[model samples]
Structure formats: C-alpha cells, structure tokens
Target: MSKGFSKEFLWGGAIAANQSEGAWDEDGKGMSVADVIKFHSKIYVKDYKKQMEITSQQIEEAIKDKSEKKYPKRRGIDFYHKYKEDLALFAEMGFKTLRVSIAWSRIFPTGEEEKPNEKGLEFYEELFTEMKRLKIEPIVTLSHYEMPLELSVKYNGWEDRKIINLFVKYSKTCFKRYKNLVKYWLTFNEIDSIERHPFITAGIIPEQCKNIKQSIYQAFHHQFIASALVTQECHKIIPESQVGCMLTKLTTYPNTCNPEDVEKTLIKNLLNYFPADVQVFGEYPVIIQNMLEKENIIIKKESGDEDILKNNTVDFVSFSYYMSLTESANENSEKTAGNTIFGVKNPYLPSTEWGWQIDPKGLKISLLELYDRYKKPLIIVENGMGAVDKVETDGKIHDDYRKEYFKKHFEQMKEAIEMGVELFGYTSWAPIDIISAGTSQMSKRYGFIYVDQDDYGNGTLKRIKKDSFYWYKKVIESNGEDLE
Candidate 1:
C-alpha cells in the first residue's frame, strides 16, 4: 500500500437532504421531484442505446401524463426530527466533518421570494450549531437535487435563466447565515447527473422544454451561472471559507487492452467531464460543442455567464466515487447491470446486487486524473459500498463486506496521496444508513451504523453499530493505517 495520508486528514460521512432527511413535508418544506418518483424494486438494467435515444420531451410527457401508479411516501427515518440523536451517533464514530445539504425549499419556500423563511433557516442553524458543538466541521452542499416544486412549476426550474438569480439569493442566505459554522460549501451536487436526469433531479419534466438536449443544456447553462455566481458571493461574504462543486465521479475503464476500447474509454471520460469542465474550465470542449451544433441544439447564454465561470472557478473539486464502468464499441457485449449513463460491462470486475461494479482502484485513478487536470485539492465527498445487510438474531450486523470494501479503497487512497494528489479529506457516503436514493428503501444500506429498516418500511427505528462502524473509527483514528 502507498504511504498513509497526512496526519491532519479529515474523515467523515456524506449525505444529502433529500435522501437522509425525511421531512418531505414539514416546516413549510416544498415537495421536490424526489418525493414523487417511485423506487426501483429490482436492479436497474441499462440499455445504453435506448437510454441515449430518450429525449427530454419524452420524459416530460411521461411525467405530465401522470398515469403511472404512485409510490409510497419516503417519510421514513425522519432525520428532520432525529438529527440530534443521529449526529450524536456520528460524533461517536469520531467524525472530523459531517457533509450534508440544506433543502432549497426549506430555505426559500418559493424560489423567487424576496425574504427567506425564518423557521427554515432556523432548522439548519440548529443542526449546524449541534455539529459545531461536537467540533465537527460542516461540509454543506448548497443544492442537492432538491428544488422547490414551485420553482419547477412556475419558472421551469433551471431551464429559465431567472432561476440563476433566485439560486444566488438562496446561496447568499446560506453564506450569511451559516458562514461562521460552514467552512466548506458545494454549489451543486452532481450538476452533470442532474442535467442527465432532469425529471428525477429538478422535477422540471423534459416535456416542458420541447427538446431534451436543449433543455438539459439550458438547465446546465443556468446552473453553471448560478454556481459561478454563488462562488463569487461566498468569497465576498465568507472569505475564510472554501467553496467547491461536487460531481458523481462514475469512473470508466476500458473493456479490453485493445486500442479501440481505450479510445472508447477516452470518449466516455470526456463525456462525463463535459458539464463540469465547462463550469470549472470556462469553455465547452470542442467535441461536445460540435456535436451540439450538429444537432442544432444551441444553449442560449445570458450576458455575463462566460465571464462569471472564467473568473470564478471552484476552490476545490469534490466527487462521489462509488463504482466504475467499463466501455466498449460493441453494444451487445455482456455488461454489468449498473445504473450508469454508459451501461457497459467490466469483464474483470464483480458487481453489487444493484449492478454497480466494485472497483476500489478506480478511486485512486479518479483522484490522480482530477488533481492533474484541475491542479486543485480534491475532497472525496462520498464513497461507499451499498449492500443488503443481514441482521443477526442478536441484533448485530457483521458487515465484513463493507469493511473490506472500504479497506481496499482507503489503501488505494493512500497510494494516490503519495502520488502527489492533494486530497483534502474523505467522507464516506451515509455514515449512518438512511433511505436509498434509487430504491427509496432502507434495505440498500451503505452506512457504518446500520439503521433497522427494510423495503416494506417495517422495523424498529433502531440504530445499531455494524462491525464496520468500529472498523472505520479505528482507520480514521489512525489516519488510515489501522485496518484489520
């Protein structure tokens, strides 16, 4: 293994508002698109060509039709009400930082409101204060796939340029209110994924925009402007704090040693980086622009968007690297049944029940590549293995698989650090397992401390420390060397 990380390395857990905090309708919180989407009961199989063919209008029309049966409400775990206890559990795990997001609707209620909601602001204030009391730094995502339903309905979400100004207003409020406590901020979580899954991310069905690529590009345009503008605002308001953008780093590997496979891998890498590179590097990659122009989908730009992105790049790059994908030109080749954009298979790797490929080495590759390209300190905002844990009759979950998964990943991270990747921290996803994002169930667990719950939503709302919990605490305490 490579040399261990710096002694001052931060170790913690990452979660989002919509996923863990299940007060979907409380304290004036507006409904988000997540509230309406059905959970995936079975593993999501990817048909790459079919997924590629799906347009924004097609998705939007399906949403508008509303003939689909409704799923159960995701009001389980109730982190809104249980954060105090939950945070205490996090503190027990020796967390140096706690990554979470503030719900947009909770803070703004209406996207364009002149005055913010005091109660909404107060909820986060108390949450942050609790973290501060425990000496845990707050890593805040300004927006995490949770937008006010009102915004999507009235302003067409990020497709409308007006939302940029409103987003800035909300971000500024977060800066001013939590400036003292929040030292790290992310403008948006997985901005690229949101563009890819707009109906799921922002609730602005693609039908509203008439064109998928145009809608996605337009939505991304506004998000880029907002992220850049918010970075500038945070600097102005909180000079000491660092602001960044978070992306879902679904790393890709070549299907074979063949040059064609390598070339396909490179193309997929470029496609993954398209949204973020444009936001951080200020100009669109020539290939993507050429493709858009060929397709006649021009992203309309406002006056100062380019200048904003050019002048205000994020201070750091953060991402969640759960798994990797292997790419090939042959579409019919057997692939892992994963929930990735390029749903190709990795011949050499095993996969989780959910179809995500298990690839700890990909983490090291991702860190090296991102650091080389951006020349900025990297923060791994989320990395964890999601699995079904069997609770023993004694009420303890061994979870050795989780322990082994993280151990290998941490070892590789040590290698990346020695290779000169300036890593700021590593925060595993779901320090305490909450609801699963894709399945909207607690069964697809990814936490060190497993909460007693299941797909049918029946179990004591009990929190038990899985064996991995103690295992990770030791690793963190030793600065990533103590793994047994």
Candidate 2:
C-alpha cells in the first residue's frame, strides 16, 4: 500500500566489542573501563546515584579480584575468537550490515600511547575482511562505552582537555587502517549517557572529582571537540564514507493533559536531546546553554572549538530506542526505570522482564520527531527486548514474544518510511546474545541466535538458532516484506 524500503537499505544487528568479545587481555588487549565493572544484582540497576560514583578504590579491588563470576564483562562471549562462525551465521540470516565497536584499549593499550598495537589492528583487519568477503557492510562505532582503564585512573577521563588529542589519535589510526572495510562510523555510543553512568560512558570516576557536575560538563565539551575533530579526519581519510552521532532516544510522554505536565515533559526531553543537538546542528541550544549557566557550570573551550564543531557536522543521525518514558509535574509521582533512563509508569504499556516498558509506537514517534528536528537521514542502531529465554526439550527455542516485539516495531518503522522519513538502515540491538550491559549477565538474552552461557560464565559457548532467528531471516530475505 506504500512505497517500500529502499534497494540498499541496511538490515542487520549490532554488538559492542567489550560486550561480545571475551579475550579482555589477549593479543595485546588491555583492560577497558568495562572490564573492571562488577556484576551487580537487579536492585542496583536503578540505583544510578551509587553506580555513577565509582571510586578508585573500587577499581583497585576489582582489578585484584580474579573472579569472572563477579565481573562477567571481563570475559565476554569470546567474539574475539568466534567472530568467523558468528559472521557466517549473520550472513546466513541475510544480514546486509553488522554494527560493531572497536575496543579503544585494544588499539591504544593506554590512552597515552603514540603507536597502536599491531596485533590489535591485525585482529580487526582479519575480522573486517571476512565481513567484506561475505558482502556484509560494517557500521563501526569508535567508542562504545569502553575506553582504556588507564585513562580514567590516571587522567580522570575526558575532563582534561588533553583527552581530545588522545581520542583524535585513536580515531585517526582507525580511520586510516579500516577505511577500506568500513564506511559508516559513529563517534560515540549514547553520548548523552555520561551523566547517567560516567565510568561506562566517558571513563570518568565520579568519586574522584570534587565537583562532579563541573567535571561532567567539561568532559562533554572535550568529547564534542573530539567528535568534531574525528569527523573531519574521517572525511579526509575516507572521502566516500559517512559519519554519525549516536544517542539514546529517550521519548517522553506527559502523564496527563495538564499544561504543567506538558511543559515538564518538554524540559525532560531536552535533557536527552542536548548532546545530539550539538552534533547535528553544530552548536548548543540556547536553552541548554542557559541551563548550564544556572547550574554554574563553566565549560572551558579551546580557541577553535566553535569552528571545528561548526565546520564538520555529522552526515546522518543514529539512535537506540527501547522504551518511552512518562512524565508528570507532580513531585510525588510513581516512577519507573528503563535502560539508562527513569520516568513515570504508563499504565497502558507493558514491560519486559527487565522492567523496560514496551512501546512500539514510541519508535515511530522518535523517528518522526528526529526527522522533523534534524532533517537528516536516520538509522535505528539498537532496538531489542531482553528476556529470560527457555529452551524446550527438543533443543529448539520458541520465542514468540520476542518475535512479536520486533514485528510491531518493524511495522512502525515501515509506517515512518511511508510518511516520508528518510531512513538509511535498521540494526537491532544484538544479532547474538552477549553479556548484558547493565547487569553484566549472559542470561538476559536479546538475540535471534542464543549463546550457551550463564550468569556464572559457565556453558559450552555453543550457538543455537531460536525460532525468531528463522522468522527474522525471512524478514531480511524479503527486505521487511514478511513479518510472520
């Protein structure tokens, strides 16, 4: 009934290297910020205040604790060793693209290194070549919630202006090395999340800072300059390539029709949109600037920072949409949490096993709002439900709920295109199950292909295709024409 997806629309899945690759210290790989993060119970997921305050003492203790059981991210699903088989499975699923992040510590070892580790570069080279051979285009994220642990411990993350150059060095090496194999690049994963989880997002240990707010904003400034600088270098190295900024598209709905509630919702949405607005429009929105001033936060900027941001804006905008948040003006309102965001509960919507509210229409709203705001090509880089999957006696998984979730979201995506949104691609959160980002558990699965692993890091590490795997294969094979 409507004009369908474009001929070259990218359809695939995405996984961060630190979340999927196990060999945390193999082949010259150094410890990343992700490696030292411990696996907390479900109760800690919503205690953002405590999580954000990661101290140096905690880091020292985590480094000494030689238990993979406590630190599941230290040993990811071993994608460092099993990428070939995984890519083969993705290719069999008719994936047109695969979104992956290059571990910064793998290449730089430490943020101060002048030369990259040749072994680290060699590994990604082999990985990308195989993807190219299978005709699978690679969309790479330069920094995806993982930076050198040494950076945070020694330099206090991106707060120091010198981190700009360090990040640029890492970016230049990647741009020059993998220019042939990858064309699409994202500067940062969820650049807006630094305030929520400073350690994971920007390698900042909040407990070390006297004024965390000031440090956070200063880091944001450095990252903005770094993103712009890398974007400029990416163009110089790969003339035909495209670069984008990724954000957590936090959609908010007013709890009621009251004008005050609507105003509160507007302000809440701006908090999440601030970073993306800078990357896409090349300047901070006036409201955000005013908010910073009110908070007494002064961001130290270099001489040409304005010029760099203005001259080199992103080519497209990518985002991860998992849930919609409800907002109310009432101070004492019922609240809930979802994948790095908090909001009031919407009674009409259901939640996943992990408490992330499911709102398929929210994806449509995000696409429409983003298109209207930026007028640039949009890509949904991550969107999937995490659930505790059970295998029947026959060794086959029947995950109809997961299938329904994607089907509804895919329908909304198609409707968005019909309404004149210029979408470039859609890569689901993960093609294969990896360690959970929040809880660091392998049991919280969100993949068409399941990895045989558990919370205690025990299993054969075998790959089994769920029923949704076959269903998604047909969807990709038909170019989103078939849903059932």
Candidate 3:
C-alpha cells in the first residue's frame, strides 16, 4: 500500500472560470482576452495555409511549427452554467477542496470600477455556498489572467499604477463576501508566466509599452503590488484565511553532467523561483537585480511597495509543476515547444504528443526546492498530462496512460513529503477536461471525466468517465494508499 498522507491531507480538482465557464457575456460579465483566441487547430492550420501560399514546400515547415489552437476553444466547457453538475461530479470523486478562480471581469465588469458588480458578486456567493453545501472547501484565486479587456485598452493593463489599487479593491470585495467559505486565497494564477508572456496571457504587447523590458517590469511591479495589497486586505478582512501566490513551475534540468552545463541549469532554475521569492520572501534575488541592472531596466519601487511585500508575505507558496526543461546557450540545441517562453526539451525525459516533457521526478525536485528556499507550505495547484484519447466501441475511454502518469507523480510526491516538504495538497490541472491553455483546444484532453466535445465544437457536452476516473477515485479514497 502507498504511504498514507497526514490526517489533514487535501485532495481535490482545480479549474479556472475562464478556462471552464463559457457564459463569457452572461450575467453582466465583461469580455476577457480568452474570449478572442480561437482553438489550437485553427491557428496551426491557418499558419500552414499561409506558408503554403508562399511555397508548397513550406507546408512541411509550417506543419512542423503548427502545434494546435487555430482558434480559441469554444467559450470554454460551459462550466458557468454547469458548475452545479461539475461540482457534483467532483464530490463523487471525494474532493475535499475545489480550487477555482473568480473571473475578475465578473466582479468589476470594467477593471476600474469604483463600485463592484452585484450580479457578479452574487454568482460567486452562490458558487461558494454550493461548495459549502457539498462540504468541499474552496481555494479561490483572485486573478487568473482574466483581466478586464477594458483595462488593457484604457490604461495599457497593469502598466499604470492605478491598476494596483483597483485590483486591491476587487480582491477586498471578494474577501468580505466569501470570507467564511474560502479559507485559502491566492493573489494571482501563474503571475510569473503572465509577466513572461504578457501578450498571450493578458494581450498587453510589450512593444506598445515603451519597450519590452519596461512593459514586463511594469507588469511584474503592478502584480507584486496588487498581491501584497491583497494579502494585506485579506488579513484585515479574513484574518484567519491563508493567502499565497501561484506560479507556473517550469523546472529546468542540466543539458549534460558537465560542470558548465550544470551551472547554467542552476541559473535557469533560479530564474523560475526568483519571481516567487521576491514576492513571498520580500526581496528580489541578487542575481535578478543584477541582471535587471545589466539590461538597464530600472524597476521603479513605489512608496511602501517594499513594506507591502515584507509585512504581507504569503502564508504558502503554491505552484503548478507541469514539466521540466533543459536549457543551453548553444543556439542549435533542439527547441522544445509548450506553453511557457522558457520551455525547452529535456533530452532524458519522454515527451507528450504536444512535445511537453514528462518527468514525475521533476515534480518532486520542484517541491523540495521551493520548500527548501521558502520554508513555507507548498500547494501543488496544478499538474497533469494533456493527451489524445480514443473511445472504444463500448463508449468508454481506457486511458491507462493518464493513470500511469498520475501514479508516477504521486509516488514521487509521497517521497517529497517524506523528505520533510510541508506539502499542503495536490490538485490535478483540471478534474474535468476543459480548454487547453496553450492551444485553446478541447481535443488535447486532460480530465479524468472526458467531456464529449471535439475540435469543431460538436457533441452533447456529455461527461464520460475515463479509466483514470476510477483509478483517481480509489487514490483519493485510500488517500494515496491505492497507489502502492
């Protein structure tokens, strides 16, 4: 049998409202950047068609680069309307907690509203109430890259200092409304990735903001301030609640055992953790400040920004560990394709159909490293494999591969906990398959319960249990003992 977890171990599923909830325009909700992008196939196919217009031979080259998401996935999996049913399913899976985001636009309607939207506020009130009815705790993210589109157009997104205050107002509103329902709060989802890929994540192109460095620095600064302010607000409003930060943990591996390669890998790994360290630890890493100065990018520290971070330090460090990468200064090294800008292939690990490296051990290492550096409880907010599935004649999906994927990761996670890592919990990327973030397609399924939807967006929105569903249920029921 697997090693049993602590008595307080939390098991649950995670999803963002924008990623799962379709009613983008319903209940006075405002539009987000996710509303514009099409699915992965449409993007790749269109690119392919364009390349072929230049030369027929370019088809091969275009196809190589065309991964997925030709268009934004259909207004998500309709979770806005189906959250009741979805939550029921999660309850069936024995979810002790459900990690979801409150759509920022839903509350503010416009990013800079002095008054909050009552309808948006009421919707989440009902949502959290339902979770409480089901005895499932809610782990809520204040901002999950769903910045109001109006904010982007008017003030260039987070570039202006005004956003810091606006974000705090929005966060405070939620805290007061749902203080009893949600004990776990996160300032932002994957803020580091948003800082890294502002255009894709938030539609704020760096070129439009004076310069690339200025745009990124400004975005990071605004988010850090927002986080700090939100943490402070949460304490005053919900003093007993635990607040933390979410990062997309893209772990790095050395290209080789050589000393130079190992040194480079160490530096690359530090880059991933540096963003969280600055926010959670309240001081920017020496290496990060050195690099910023070398690049001549001065980060303007607002009055009290340092105090905000220091006094409002996060209670935990939560991260999404998807896969690991290997980096080299060598220009000709093979490039790995995935969601993040820093993503690269690890020569030692196998890759998914989408070219994402699969290394369960990397998850263990990432957990240990974060705990070692931060000395705070670590919550794995997201981790899973996205792959293609085939439905057999019996109308069942025998996804043994996904089960194996979770098995290996759980084994390593158990080891990490044994190593003295204060792990809070582990939640799969999505309990139910929704839209793929990078490609914006539903075909790249990652859910235990598969929704019968396709690339063209046809089907009954039916939820079918994959083989992994039963496997995961047992894993939860036994609290990891079934894994062994």
For residues 289-375, write the lDDT of model 2, one tens digit per residue: 999999999898878889999999999999999999789989788777787767788998999877789999999999999999999
The parts of candidate 1 lying over 4 Å away from their true place are: 46-73, 339-342
Residue-level lDDT tens digits of model 3 in 269-315: 77777769878888778888898889888888878778877887899
lDDT of 2: 0.91
Error of 3 at 312 (Å): 0.7
Q: What global local distance difference test value does model 3 have? A: 0.79
Residues 441-462, candidate 1: write the lDDT tens digits. 6678899888776666667768
**Candidate 2 clash figure, as a count:** 1
Ranking by TM-score: 2, 1, 3
**Candidate lDDT values, in order:** 0.79, 0.91, 0.79
Off by over 4 Å in 3: 1-4, 42-74, 200-203, 342-344
RMSD in Å for model 2: 1.2
Among residues 3 or more apart in sequence or in different chains, the pairs in candidate 1 whose N, CA or C atoms overlap within 3 Å are 56-212, 60-207
The TM-score measured for candidate 3 stands at 0.92
> Distance from true position, residue 301, model 2, in Å?
0.8
Worst 10 residues of 1 by lDDT: 65-74
**After aligning candidate 3 to the native by TM-score, how far in Å is the CA of 371 from where it should be?**
0.8
Top model number, lDDT: 2
